[model samples]
Target: MAKRRKMNYASPSTNKIPVIFSIAVILIGLLVVMSSLKKFTHTPDQGAIEENVQMKNEEFINRLVPVAKELHQAHGILPSIIIGQAILESDWGSSELSAKYNNLFGIKSFSPNDDSIKLKTKEFKDGKWIEINANFKVYASWEDCMRDHTLLFVNGVDWDPYLYQGVLLASDYKTAANALQAAGYATDPDYASKIISVIEKNELYQYDK
Candidate 1:
């Protein structure tokens, strides 16, 4: 007679442990991969971002071309210089002064008879930026605002070169930008550079022709 050997089997729960652990590990790895992909898609490339801004600025400049040409005809100031100044001072005609008062040049009000609006503004003084409440001249139309800006450069009805000689005598956009700084057009020390940057970046000199 042969003795039968006793048979033993492992419990089902213990058998399933390896399978459950592998499933859990795979789920965790999938989650990590998904998270990485999400970040990559959301991140913006610097070059693309800058290109978008340039496109927007170009669109804004194109929209104002007609007015710039009109100003060029009325006054000898280069359309490029005027448009660059407008973009710098008024933020592409989107500033509070431009939006509400049509004040594109940030010119202070000296004429009491002219319609005006009071607004908070920053001025560079004593080598510091100072907040001040200023009265800015308001124009009934954008053309009027552009005309006023031209008058500031030429001054009086005579078209005398003596008043704003630095501006009127400028031979080109670059010279005009530099002249504006020399003539104290803005309080900022880098005002000319800022305007020049805008003009060059957009190739505004083409408008001078």
Candidate 2:
């Protein structure tokens, strides 16, 4: 009779292969779940953000209307345009520059003699927005800022005395808006439309009267 060959016993490590594979699969699944959760957590709640901004805008307008009326009466600058510009440039007086320095018009300092606050700002230049550090005039209060803005139109900047004549000559808010764009009050191509929209939406023309 032929002698039976002894069967080789399988190693214990080989028996554990299924267990290792199951652990790896579980770990991979957990990683995928964690990645999905991370993405969900980082997504912004756009509606909530927008609602907060709107509430702030309303509050700013309320606080501004009386002060703006008084300034306009004194300066003869169109209140509608002033309010619109303040809303646009200051983000309803909530921007850092406006809140801290009372710079509502984004006017840059043209002379070394001018007292200034240095800050990072964005400009619409050569068909794109560019970042730069600029010297902006500082003010003791929002009233001072309003007064200075009106004076800027009447007196012009030291560098260009005739810079604001177009805006100064305009007969109405719409005309003033267009003239400001022509005078390069802002570099945005749609600056006139944006100003006009703000004026109309808030019935800002009433303040002009």
Candidate 3:
């Protein structure tokens, strides 16, 4: 008897297996797509967040702008420096310096012979920084400090950053920041950037330049 020839025809059972595998692959692909979409999806609570920020900024301006204007009018100086100094040193007028001293510029006592009342400061005496109970100019009011600032700048004090009274004062904020940095007016790590930031953000330069 001749050996039976092996049949090469695929049975219905073979077709069923591929169909089941294809269905599983399609389902897996769908699941993968869904998971990828889920990971990147974001629900935006749009207007509410922006509105709160705007409101807070408005409130800050409402409370603080008068002080800036008063400082500006009292002395022919641009209020941006005062406002920037106040905002930076005072952390938007919340620091102890702002509350009690109201000396926004961190003005140090330059002269012992001078009669301006002073604050005890830490100064390097021999090798280490020592706390010296010495005089630092005290202001009866913010207006007084503002006046002193004006005088200090008018005299072209070494640390007068803007040197506003100079004949060839900087025409813009960047120039002022650079001139100030070169003049040793500020020891801030980001003095130029900070001043420029405040000037630009608040549009405070409009008052003078």
- Tell me the whole-model lDDT of each prediction, alpha carbons only: 0.84, 0.85, 0.63
lDDT per residue (tens digit) for residues 161-184 in model 3 = 445453225555577666555655
Alpha-carbon runs more than 4 Å astray in model 1: 1-55, 156-161
lDDT of 2: 0.85
How far in Å is the alpha carbon of 109 misplaced in model 1?
0.5
- How would you order the candidates by TM-score, starting with the best? 1, 2, 3
TM-score, predicted candidate 2 vs. hidden true structure: 0.70
lDDT of 2 by residue, 168-205 (tens): 66768999999889878888899999999999998889
Show the lowest summed lDDT stretch of 10 residues, model 3.
161-170
| Cα-lDDT of candidate 3 | 0.63
